[model samples]
Target: MTTSTERAGSGLDDGPLTIGGRDFESRLIVGTGKYPDNETMVEAIRASGSEMVTVAVRRVDLDRSSEEGILHHLDPDEFFLLANTAGCYTAEDAVRYARLARAAGFNEWIKLEVIGDEKTLLPDVQATLEAARILVDEGFKVMAYTNDDLVAALRLEDAGCVSVMPLASPIGSGLGLVNPYYIREIKDRLEVPVIVDAGVGTASDACATMEQGVDGVLMNTAIAAADEPVSMARAMRLGVQAGRLAYLAGRMPRREIAVPSSPVGGMLD
Candidate 1:
């Protein structure tokens, strides 16, 4: 229940991550999918220390009373539910799912995704932008998922999306930050929060992604597919905190030649 700062103490206290006017103590956001069972998923989520969790409207069992339903397992009062358009391939379909979640009285925040390809699982920039526009017009806090490109990120921010989510690699690839430069560029250029979503294979990936100075990271497969999901989840929480702290501390300038720690004029021998 404690935040990264609370657990790490004053030195690591970077403060809460704010998205769409809501402040979450944890900067790591996680997805609810790919676990063997709901119990494991809940335990893993709790371990990750994430306050906001994503749910694909198409996949959730809407009957809140059902034991197997995500709603039953993840208490809405405990975690902020972010509805997403996971499987939708078209702008209209993505919009439909977003609207469906809203009609069901779920939260208005959306993790908008219009998948362009089935094999690659890349997002369709055009469809994603179109869907974001519609969702924003409808008063939904849209968090668009797109490839790591500054132009697309800028467009999404201009389209009134609450946050811009750029993939570290193709969805579920676990490639672990293929293009950190692009993520940095997107973060440097955008006004809204930038969250690196997908392509994180392990704790190091989450750490590396945060080192780019992004606002946060969103991942699923990295934790869910791990052999020890609960343990991996805890590791990821620490990784995110470590990376953020390292970034804030700042790294020394990269140099081609090595510098002696002791004064060069003084000889120990």
Candidate 2:
């Protein structure tokens, strides 16, 4: 497969939109998980040019000698921390963790996640929607992660979420997109920003989602788990830009017959 650089020319696409009153330069959001170390995560985030990065919150381990050191590596001023309620099982639990994030001085930007199953890592749609509604009403900019279910996505939007991030596949599967038609349909019906989160394996997958006209992408394992995390992050950035540009540029119509631009028999006639 051709690299994004080979497929798309060299240039930066237009910057991000001011969603929920936050000014993000790049539309590609990254997660700070599964990297080899904190330093590598920082490097990957830098290469990705992602202004918003996700961080998960769980019960504090009192036995550990030192703190978990998850967000300590990241410079808070430079990165907008999107704290996630990943381990929460119910809407109330997720809401409590979200409140904790706010108390920790990380603003109200949150990735609301309520897990229903451990095996599949699928979110509880009812719990997620409940948490999203509660968060939005409480003045938080909620970005709910859910299975690639169109009705669930619409429900989140109807609950007043600023953005709805539907998973392309299972969390951490690196499967790219399993059901793209649903994603396209969700994007068409929802007025809020639609982000393709989770299950993105390569930069091409990111580009494909953008080409489908989604507002943004939230990728994690694809970058953090890659052999060269930094390079993969950079590739994802370019791929996203290329995809967005292609969408805006308007694709050419497909034809049954090839149309030659060069004239035939012009020299010896």
Candidate 3:
């Protein structure tokens, strides 16, 4: 049996291992939150071709733990399980939850998000940075979920996070990149990988983020809420490829005049 220990960084290394020794194959990470059902979520995952999926770790209901429908639906081996401390309010709480997740079946890869404010769903940078630093020191590969604040992003990167996952818009807003330039700047300045984490509405939004040189995109609402999730998933896959290809291909400069090649007057003559 291929245990999580043996496969620690196996599939993840298909692409780049950004930080803290965790690797990822595809540049896209899909979140398992906000989907309509288990089947649809599974379909979306298959369509997206995403190797990593985010799973939130809350207090498992002691009474109904065995009957938790959603938990059972997820196949641990199919996707790289990135357990997140979504409901945590403090650094200590987040760290404890991460430990708990590790104790459970989930791996050491954690999406460290400490959001005390429910309205904005924005991360508490102070607490987030503290938690991230501690998590990194404790040997967990921290993928810090943060706001689009470049300063905070840099702080998280400096704190030894595996990757900085900044929100494209507010969580579940689906408004796409409110300020793409900031994300672009982060990609430009930071040494570690930057993944656009939330609020992307369509495939174009994902492409836009990738075009800005972001290492990857993490989306939930955009695909989950789509009228046809499978179709959306396919779109996202193509969009990611298009964006990556464009980035690598490099665009040509704008020209004021067209240079004629095959004898401009030959056709008329």
Candidate 4:
């Protein structure tokens, strides 16, 4: 019998993840938040091996001294900065932030997030859809962050979003795939990339998301809040790669009856 480990090595080079006409080999998309310091953030990001990093537009001070701002630490050549409309509660606010991000020289890519409640931080589906539609029509490549509602996800896709990002749980909750069924359903129905945006606590959470055949994951608190952010980042990177490999390799089915690993007939009683 071929073991799962033996099969995992093949077909790893599945090809690049293309979003909004850009191709990236790294499927892990990280966030710039909740870090101890800027130096640590840079090191952790480097260790994560993520090609894209999400930045909260409202949090950035564009006019601040170069040495004091987050943008100074992130080299554009090393990573693709995905400016997100985090903390925006309304469609207009989200849209305004996207424009500000673009004017700051981040370009057309935007991660659209419109929070409905302060407690759960769950996305406001109606406001999210409204913002997404407007952004898409305005020529911005929008990656919408929405709840794990299949209908909402479909509507976002219809609104011309380049990718649909569903939450595993509430943002920063670290609940880890609260509704896998919904995520799977979204993936099955949508043609665009389906990325799990929030609620990943550790490496295993990320691994599980990738095994669901998601194109990628966007996490912040997971790595930033870890005891060792750099080490955790590396773990997440490996977990994502391993999970992707396992998914492509196909897992063995489980059986009710006991099955011996060695040859059953040849074994001595």
Candidate 5:
């Protein structure tokens, strides 16, 4: 009798999430921000059961010896450290950051973000596409973070991105899955993995996002800002797995009218 805990991160259910020839058991990728402390961040990350932990490259110094840097606290052998161009506002800025980050990390994988506006924090898709092409040309595996637009997603993939990340909502809004149709449409249209990033508010949010049949979900504030981050991380783990499983199970069709269960033609008859 295998309990859910035993099977949670076992890689037995969801299988490996492959990005640019790298394999990951967990689909719940997380960020290294908004935690109260380094210890809490580490514990929450472990509890989340994510194989890859993404750090905002723009926010931290890549020098591993820097005690203040998040990399100093993380062991590369244990967790795959993914660098993201978090705050860069233009393709040039993101490309520069990506080059610097990869030089230090000795890896070409980068989560590219080129924010369009300070107020909404939505991505500048044009800049993101430009960065993706540049990074791809430089032999980097770019995972682009963009809005939920099918055309934009297709363009990113065409630009040679390894993965396309669509926001569930604005960053840190905790809005949950606001547009499942667009997400599903994007997933259906793209050959690359579609990871739903940002805007997941809770366990149910993560679950709902995954149930839309996207490859995975990446989140930060949802877990880090929780009153009990570790607990929330654990819940998010369950949520992601459950959602993936539910999607695999193939949900029953939706109906406009109620259908009775157990043959409702007078129970005694």
Candidate 6:
């Protein structure tokens, strides 16, 4: 029997996470928001061992006279910056943000989010798909943030999105996989990467999400809102790795009756 640690070390974890023809070693993608300070955010990101970081274009202070900015904290050479259209509520607004992100010298990689309601922050599927098509036609590698609707996910994929990110729950609700079956269904049908994007509360939530056989997870509030951000970041990193290893190793079947771990005939009567 191969131990989980041994299996993880034996090159079973060697496959790079490929999306939009880009490869990443780490499957956990962190976001640059809600952190108390830039230094703390940087530390948390480094501790998480995340290779990709998502930034909201609307939140950036483009008119700042100083050179210091979120971009300064995130080294482009070390991290793949994923510019997001977080505050955009319509297809046109999302497209405009994508253009602004491109003009900021970030590549055409976009995390497209078209929100419908301020209360729930749930994605507007129709608008999201519309923006995705527009962005894809303009040569952007779109990673769409959408609701956990399988049909909508397929539509986004058909619109040429590089990845389909279905929400586990409402944004920042910390609800944690309210409808996991839908996510699994989306993963089963999609050829592209399927990433769970929101409502992960902690390490276990992330672990559960990964064990669903999805490609990756993108989270912001979970780590930032933790009591100790850096420690939480480390926990998330380990949880993601452990969950991926467990998925690859294959879990033992659950039984309704008690089963002996050792040989049943070997015990004294």
**Reference-based TM-score, model 2:** 0.88
lDDT of 5 by residue, 157-208 (tens): 9999999999999999999999999999999999899999999999999999
Q: Spell out the clash pairs found in candidate 6.
A: none
- In the range 1-269, model 4's lDDT, one tens digit per residue, is 65655445434447788888899888899998999998889999999999999987655458775586677788988899999999999999999999998888867999999999999999999999999999999999999999999999999999999999999889999889888888989999999999999999999999988888889999999999999999999999998887787777677897999888887686676
- Score residue 193 of candidate 3 by CA lDDT: 85
Tens digits of per-residue lDDT for model 2, 51-170:
999988766788884546676688988988899998899999999999988788868888989999999899999999999989999999999999888999999999988889998888
Clashes in model 2: which pairs? none
User: What are the runs in model 1 whose C-alpha is more than 4 Å off?
Assistant: 1-13, 59-65
Indicate whether candidate 4 or candidate 5 has the larger lDDT: 5
Stretches off by above 4 angstroms in model 4 are 1-11, 59-66
Q: Provide the global lDDT of candidate 2 against the true structure.
A: 0.87
- Model 6: CA > 4 A from native: 1-6, 10-14, 59-68
User: Which of 2 and 3 is ahead in TM-score?
Assistant: 2
Q: List the global CA lDDT of all models.
A: 0.91, 0.87, 0.83, 0.90, 0.91, 0.90
Candidate 6: tens digits of C-alpha lDDT, residues 1-269? 87877766643755888999999889899998999888889899999999999987755457874455677677888888999999899999999999899888868899999999999999999999999999999999999999999999999999999999999888888888888799989999999999999999999888888888889999999999888999999999988887787777778888999987788786787
Best model number under TM-score: 6
Candidate 1 residue-wise lDDT, 15-96, digit = tens = 7788889998888999999998899999999999999999877554586545666887899888999888999999999999
Cα TM-score of candidate 3: 0.85
> How far is 46's C-alpha from truth in model 3 (Å)?
0.9
| Each prediction's TM-score versus the true structure | 0.92, 0.88, 0.85, 0.92, 0.92, 0.93
The stretch of ten residues in a row with the least summed lDDT in candidate 2 is: 6-15
Residue pairs whose backbone atoms clash in candidate 5: none
Candidate 2's error at 166, in angstroms? 1.0
Give the residue spans of candidate 3 off by over 4 A. Answer: 1-22, 62-65, 69-71, 253-269
lDDT tens per residue, model 3, 64-183: 756564568978888888888988889999999999888886678899999958898888989999999888888898989998889999999999988898899988898988898898
